[model samples]
Target: LHNTSDYRVLLMDEDHDRMYVGTQDYIVSLDLHNINREPLIIHWPVSQQRRDDCVLSGKDQNGECANFICLIQPWNRTHLYVCGTGAYHPICSYVNRGRKAEDYIFHLEPGKVESGKGKCSYDPKLNSVSSLINRELYAGVYIDFMGTDAAIFRTMGPQTAMRTDQYNSRWLNDPEFIHAQLIPDSSERNDDKLYFFFREKASDSGSSAVYSRIGRICLNDDGGHCCLVNKWSTFLKARLICSVPGPDGIETHFDELHVKNPVIYAVFSSSGSVFKGSAVCVYSMTDIRTVFNGPFAHKEGPNYQWMPFTGKIPYPRPGTCPGGTFTPSMRSTKDYPDEVINFMRNHPTMYNSVYPVHKRPLVVRTNVNYEFTTITVDQVDAADGRYEVLFLGTDRGTVQKVIVLPKDEMEREELILEEVEVFKVSQQLYVGSTLGITQVTLHRCDVYGEACADCCLARDPYCAWDGKACSRYSASSKRRSRRQDVRHGNPIRQCRGYNSNANRKTMETEQYGVEGSSTFLECQPKSPQATIKWVLQREGSDRKKEIKSDERILRTDQGLLLRSLQLADGGIYQCTATENNFKHALVRVHLRVLNNETVNLVLTHSGLPMASLQGVGSPGTSRAPNPQYKDLLQLLSQPEMGVINQYCEGYWQRPANIEKQNLNKQQKDKPVREQRKPRNRRNHHTSWPQLPLLANHCQ
Candidate 1:
């Protein structure tokens, strides 16, 4: 695990408590409960001849011409069908584990390797998706070595192999496959369909526009009789639109798709370089089906625009499977008329585009550096109701745990990682990257904090306040005793009896700042949703006034920054947070500004020679004090006089040659001075050198 690389694919078999990982030249099987334990590894490197041939064909020997395992699908109860870019040739073999979970025997089956032309991609960089249903492999992959022939193929089944129209841009044009799913349309087995989600170059558009697509084909479709033999007779694809409305009737499109099924959660990103953005859109199966059933797009002539076809529809619609509920009379697509087959070929794309459930994205992030790469959703049954928690992975090696509350409010917490390739099974998330694989728990309820307000303000559906501590919420637990408000997160209303320190006095810390120097009052709010405000009460005053930010006084998310500290800035500053109409004081700082004269007096009394303090109050002098004198002055300004005296005594006790060496190095590194015009004495005060306070150094 430490030395191996390219750990990009992960397949979990929860029933057997094993996770299979695919990497370069190896397929690894690890224990679900403990990954660090000895894992079963199978070496599946490419043959020397194949590697030589790949290199001869202009592929990198170390990178491209390698056995990079990219696919691992369950072939049966105890066997896995694995495929790899076999030195650019693309080969697959079956991996055999024991029949039962207790049997730990795992190995690659010998003499079963086969050519994977249609099952896997030739290039490891190209994306592909596949789903095994009824022992047949339905894949969205490139069929050629050059990767120009992108197609959705059905192979490794009893029936004749079927695929999309070869070399037809209308079917697939530079497609980048995202995901594949086998969804049952009815109780009948033959009615089941295989759906492929991808993004491809738009065929109808003249420009280089890409569009996300949802393409589906009937599972039972064999071939056509006369027009399209050995090709799919029920292939239909629809545009998947995930966009946000902009000004002047313009819409911003998110064309790149990373999709998951079953209440489909698709992460889409804008392809435009100027406005980088990502969005999460949720789609229902009903809406996808409706779009597929709508009118088909057609072109009237060579240069005609794409529009809805008004021609008479063929019997047993072009996308319908044989012997399904709608068309029980036909037993095979070969029995359909030539008109139906030709129409299906000419109009594989639908007219209407499929929109998300709410016609908008659940989460939108614009002008961000990273794009969403993968997503997985887990529905949790909390005390109130069920909430869908989305774990969205980003290209920047992070995962965002997001939840949408009632009234369309959303909250998110980010989990950092080295890299991200996420696969979730049960309560564990298996993340794969080039470094290695990592297993993480679904919920860490204890990290929210101990206070009731802290727990409630988190608004995480997986955690709640159980009177004593913040812990994982269970539906069976007594709801009346627990405190959780994910919808509104009104901590004041929900934590009335839990906040015992509501009336406790706020603690104030003494902070010193030098006059004409800058210092920050640090105060971080516990909750990101809370609004921070600062108030100042002058010394010996009874009234407190709200502090407004100006050029010198800036309020940041962390705290308030007081620049060029003045005597008026010396006051008790209080940091407050307001959330859900509930206000609480977070921190208080009693700032005391030290003038230049006080600093000079402190330095003079610290046993420093008068020569070191000669230019302390003067400005624009060519003969300045040594730089080490400034370090001594900074140390002497601290209240810990005993430590300062100890350090000074030790400094002077160093060898005299070492002190001379230090002085020589300082003078050697100093920059040469340039002549400048003299300033009028009346226009500027003598710029005294200010020593930074110990508190500022700590901050």
Candidate 2:
């Protein structure tokens, strides 16, 4: 249950329903269904002499000498390839699952230690990332013990092992590797490409500053033949930006970020030096691709000014996969001319900076002190709808679930559904070192629900709407007997015209307020996409004037606002919305305005002096009500404040001369009109044929 500070490496095997955990001096495999079950443990501690040497060298044995498995990956169908910071010496090995005995669950392939320096981090605190493709392992790690010689290396291939230009600040300036993946060409017309996401120091503007970057390399990039021998010829990186919208037209950048492809979700604080709070910004794949396709940066001859290269480019553009005229059989990076490789070495970083797809972040939590270390996505089926739930793991052993909903054309709604406590530890060791999540796996939908609606709505790639229900067809017998294609199954087809419930159109509500008190008349639309309109039906008149926000009226996202109440304000207010330009929704409010004589008595009982309540205005004021009112008047305006003197004052003071009208049947078929600008009329008297004149009496 507790890995403490060493939850840095994890690998999940879905076929076996098992998750491998790599920690200090051990690698354990736990049951995916129940983590509480007995785990298969393998002791991978360092040798005694190595531990002694680590301690003698003034390093803590518990911290540095332990064999912490930094990388645990599947080699093939029957074996797992593993590597660790072998007591600062670094080692690699393979675990043969076929050779396992009844007593021992694991057996290592016997061989002398191979170089793991490039495969793992020397200091467990330093970051490292690796990916396996075509029997080759591509890694980003520090090559020296000083933690300065960083490089991107490709090994375990028939061609000579290659790496980035070493000790070159232009290529990699103090990079902290985060993630690596091999992306195959979707059209299968180009060579496979490898990508790396990290944050590194930049020297673009003659100054050093940290910036997030996305770098890419080709699979067939065997070291350059001429000037750049044994080094990558196609390495290139671009800057990434996820900043808060500034108030004074300034751009407040958040350089620290974490990327999960399709959507690169980043956590940015107030600044890099301070952790005032954190914001989660989401960038789409299109934004990242746009920056990659932008013009590359080039250095001028004399002034050394970095500018976008606009001259005629050479054959086989830098950082591009072999394709078209540039095929693998035709020529690899190894055969590239010296002029091409030399240009790439000088201009590894791009000129154009990448920005987030949305103007704002999907989720921006300002007060959270804990930094986010990783993110994993899951498609969840709920009663309301399908949600792309973000399972964000923090360095403080807390995981948060986030959902992004669309609000408007340029805005999004970020909902933090819940926060789960993963560990019971009272104290944490480091700021961002303890309880780091290495992997997160969401189970298949066959275990979710039996109802087809819930299952299909989940939209999980692992699930299919199998006519009868949403089921995991991949594991079902129907997959083999009927030859069902789970990947191509259409879940959305089963959910057409699936309206859970219809919206209520007509609503009745009541409000009470003092003559000079300000109040809010709420009439929010059920759907966020709907537009709201307010109409005022004046007392003792058959006219209903369309209301708009001006000096005395204010419009808000929630509802409409009336600056201050008066005798003329007493009327029936109609709030309506038209969604999809057809369906209508509305609510009616009967506002009751009290005179000074009635409010004065009500405030006397609420424990306020008569002089303090003078701001309620005179009994008969010719001018309009004041923009501000006293606290007592504001309190008496609220309907809930009626309890203060319910028995003595009869709560709401109603005009004894007014008469009520029964129009429930007429209000049922209320017609919705198209939205338009409210007409400017001095006499506040207008009639609509579609709207019937209902009684303006208040209860």
Candidate 3:
């Protein structure tokens, strides 16, 4: 599938060496093997060589690509539908559009065949049609008569004679339908009947109800039949979801109903007041009274009984309404109500109109609650009574994927949230509110044929295909071999190290200057061409201070930026990236920017001043000074790099060669005493304990 050019969504068919992609404009199929390991990419509909073909077709001038596509074998042959961003029109093509029905081009591309024309074509009439099957594109149209509900249409087949069917009915004349699901049993070709499902709310307040409806038309139904009476019929009617409360509010938007496996999954976007974000619910296909309740299964009394919808839909319960305020509106009868007058007041959407329905159809029928900000689309796959996989693609181009784990009795899929990402499909994921396509093509390099074991083994880790094998070097063997690193450098890579000054104790702070004086925000290892932007948020204020000068700020290679000082530039300066979206380290710098000078630092008296005195008067000493503070004096001689407190935790580190006895004596004395006598005067050594040492030293 081909989508918007940025990131394409691709489906790889390993068996056929094929890849299908959905795009922002048109879908493209390519043979995975033909492009080597490298891919020959184009904008859209535009192949590498024929880049202007789509422009020549007179549709997309700038060649905007399709944003999404869902490829399936819905018919006798493979069909591909391309949906794009802002393109009201959606297009379709068969992989074999240019080939004979028998000639199979598994991955639809133009070059597989010796020579062929491009098969893709555009269709303008398809409405808010998200899903398509074969050439028949089913859509939910919105018009004046019908509020948003659902509808299915024959997008491409030759127009048949007019008939009294839902497509042409006046009473059911609704294009506002949001979804139209073609029932599997709707092959009515033999009986000349077509069946599909959609929910209808005549007016915003016309008792907003859920109608599991099916439309049918006899092949012989003559043309120009009576106005609205000849068209559609409601097979099943009941109330839809209510009381949905999510983050924003209660959501009542019923998105789409999917029938796959043995279950029916229906999802509503943001269905709960509290949990009301976006919710997907599952209904058992076995408990399907409307479908399996017919006489064919009467002997078994509905052999497949669907479990009541108990997951989460958010429909209102009967007791939810205020005591006497409860009122349900009249539904469609033999004669449909006048849409221009009665139905217009009951539009079902939040913005357009309001429809209120009061009923406790089922428990799974109420707001199980999900969360969504402004999501309008959701999809869930179900099997049996369980939901298998969930795919919720938001209009913001976010695709939230959750997997369902399998259990013994529980066949439904469970939500595995750990696996989630806002990924970029080969192109954009959404055209507007749909999924874009991407392609993953597979290639095989004849490893055994090339048969170069030497070349393959040397390129350990990245194996060169050896005949029937890959020779990869083991880490243990490589370590033992200890060969010189002759590897080339990678253009893009990141390195990390601990933020420490010297002995692992370091504190970082910024320096400030006066109001008129210039300040320099400094970072280590400055680069000549590196640029920097300094953002300052005021100390107490929430607002950010703007930069007026471009000349002073500097960028450095050591992850620091220098800024020429100004009064307003004093708060917190955080360096931001200009070329990329990177918010570098944040630092709070207090730029005084004042008129008067302030004392910088009195390293001598600021905290605890260290004074080291050498024996200047005499070189010889007969007695030892004392035993206390012997090592402490030595430590005080080193330069101070940070705040110092003698009693601070883990502050003392004695000389590595000092004996434990000497260390204990220095620590326990009332005050530390140090031996200041000359090293050679041991013959007349005198020792004074702790406190008296200081007093005797003065004599």
Candidate 4:
């Protein structure tokens, strides 16, 4: 159930009801339904000789002399191809599930070792990504011991391993790999292509800067002969820009991207400074495809400068996958002449870069110091439309749940739904010391409410709008007729008939605090585009008064904060939000204030005599009440209540209560000449007796 080592690589086998996990020097298989049960763990440590050699090479024994499992890919239904950093020397092996003995829980398939230098990393901290495509391993990694030879390679094939030119900055210049996936060719005429997303140093920008890129390589490519032997023949990369046009007319770009599907979300900081904050930008797959099909960049002679190639192209094109009459044997780069192979070798990068859809990010978070490490997307169905929920994991052991509202107007903005601290700590956690998020997975759609509208509106492929309730969908369900029209259908109309009540929900709450203390009231709108308004409703008055910010009442983030509470502040406060479409959401709070005299009178209702309560905490008495009761007595004796921090704005502490003895002494020491007669003392005492025991009682 628990592993001390970082567990990042995981594969779920729904057919076997098991989950496979890769960690430091070990691979574990656990039951998906009951992970508490003992898991089958395999110890795959590096050889003792290798560990010894790592330490001899001036590396720490505790850090570098251990195998950290990096990549785990399912080769087939019965086998897994796994690779690891083998004590600073990379190596890999295949794991078989069919070899388990009858009595043993696990037995690995015996296999020969293969060099994993380009499949994993020498340093565990470095980034490397690999995926199985067309029965071959497509990987982005550092190919040398010094990690200076970064390349995208297609390894483990019949002919020979092919990679980007070694030490070639034009191909990949100081890159940090994020992830890779094989997108099935929509045309179906061409072979599938593997796309890798990464952040690398940009050269053509005329300045030292990092840019996020999406690189693609054909699966049918074979090493070129004579011209660029043992190198990729159809590898190309393009820049991905996800930036916003700032108010100052400057474009802010997010340079680190995480790709999933139709959209690729990127995290960007204003600068290299850690405290500059970060933003999440989104780019569409359509935009990426468009950029790839645009102009191609070529290296000219002089300084070998990169410029758009305008010459006539060869048949089947330079980077096209082998297709139609062109079989692998006929169209492979090895079969091409030296002239064709040399041209492609010098032009691995595309001339045009991909820009984000609408040139803006779906979500932008500001004033956050922690950089995002990983991200996952979820969807929720609402009356308006499907909301794409983004869960971004940060370096500070926290996960931020955000949502991109479907454009209700001319503009759309990202909403910060919640910020969750995944790890608990009593003190501040330091950078690099915090546990990095290895993965984020959304389990299932069972969490959606049991309404057809709820499931259908979510627009999650895993869920469908079953007539009665929101539930998981099956491929050949006889109830397909019961499902509402989704594809090419309006979501709001499908759910509007049955779920109108939730769309019109209004929130009402009551807030109670002591007079002369602070109080906070909040109203949170689901959409960030909605403008907030606050109004006060006084007793016996129907006239509405708009609340204004002053020294006594200040507006804080998403709410209102009232400092130094007074009797006049007690009223029915209402908060209303108006969206661009004129749809309104409202929340009302009835706040009541209680003075010290009224609080003391309420305590007497608990059956304690007024005189006994007053003397309960007298000094130097053996029969004195408990110290806890003394604190309570002091609290009740205070002139006013402390301020309440509503809507989680910030913290507020109350001033200590004045001692009763000091108050009595000051009253006795007052000069008779200067003393004034107590005005309506009897009337004030009589009013306290009639005060309500609870603030809500008056409401």
Task: Estimate the TM-score of every prediction.
Answer: 0.87, 0.61, 0.35, 0.70
Top-lDDT candidate index: 1
- lDDT by residue for model 2 over 1-699, one digit each (tens)? 354357667777666766677777777776666655677777777889988987787777777777778888888866788888887877888876543223335556777457787788787777778987766888998877768899998888686688999888888888989889776545554556788988888766666667888888877777677778888888889987777777898766667767676556666554545435566777776776677767888878788888898886666677766543345454567666677788788878788887776676666665666877667776654333455767776767777666676667787755443455655421111112345433322433454334343444333434554544455444424432211222222223443433121123266777665665456777755334456888889878899898888876888887777654567888998886643333333678888778787765654554444554433445443233332232233344456656555533442354443222224433443342112212110111222122123122112
Candidate 3 overall lDDT versus native:
0.31
lDDT of 3 by residue, 300-325 (tens): 12643323333222222111111112
Reference-based lDDT, residue 81, model 2: 83
2 versus 4: better TM-score goes to: 4
* Every candidate's lDDT: 0.79, 0.64, 0.31, 0.64
* Ranking of all candidate structures by their TM-score, best first: 1, 4, 2, 3
Number of residue pairs clashing in candidate 2, backbone atoms closer than 3 angstroms, sequence gap of 3 or more or interchain? 0
In model 4, residue pairs whose N, Cα or C atoms come closer than 3 Å (at least 3 residues apart or on different chains), thus clashing, are 381-457, 381-458, 518-643
Q: Which ten residues in a row have the lowest lDDT in candidate 3?
A: 486-495
Q: Please report how far candidate 4 places residue 563 from its true position, in Å.
A: 1.8
Off by over 4 Å in 2: 1-5, 98-104, 204-208, 301-305, 323-329, 381-386, 424-699
Model 1: per-residue lDDT, tens digit, 145-229?
A: 8989988888897988989999889888999999998889989887989889999998866678889999998988988999889
Give per-residue CA lDDT, model 4, range 1-699, as digits (tens): 233366677777666666677777888776666554677888888888999999999887876678888888878767788888998999998877543322334546676678896788888778789988656788888877777888887777565788888878878889999888777556554567888888888876466788888888877777677767778887878988777687999776767665655567666555554425566667777877777777788767787677788987665566667652344446565777666677677767788888766677666766756777667676644333455777777777777766555555446645554465655521111111123222223324455445544455344444566666655655456764334433322345555555554335557766665544455677665434456889999877898899989966887556788755566778898887653323333678787755546645654443334553432212222232322232232233333433111201121122224334534554576465124421101001111222212211211
Deviation in Å, model 1, residue 109 alpha carbon: 1.5
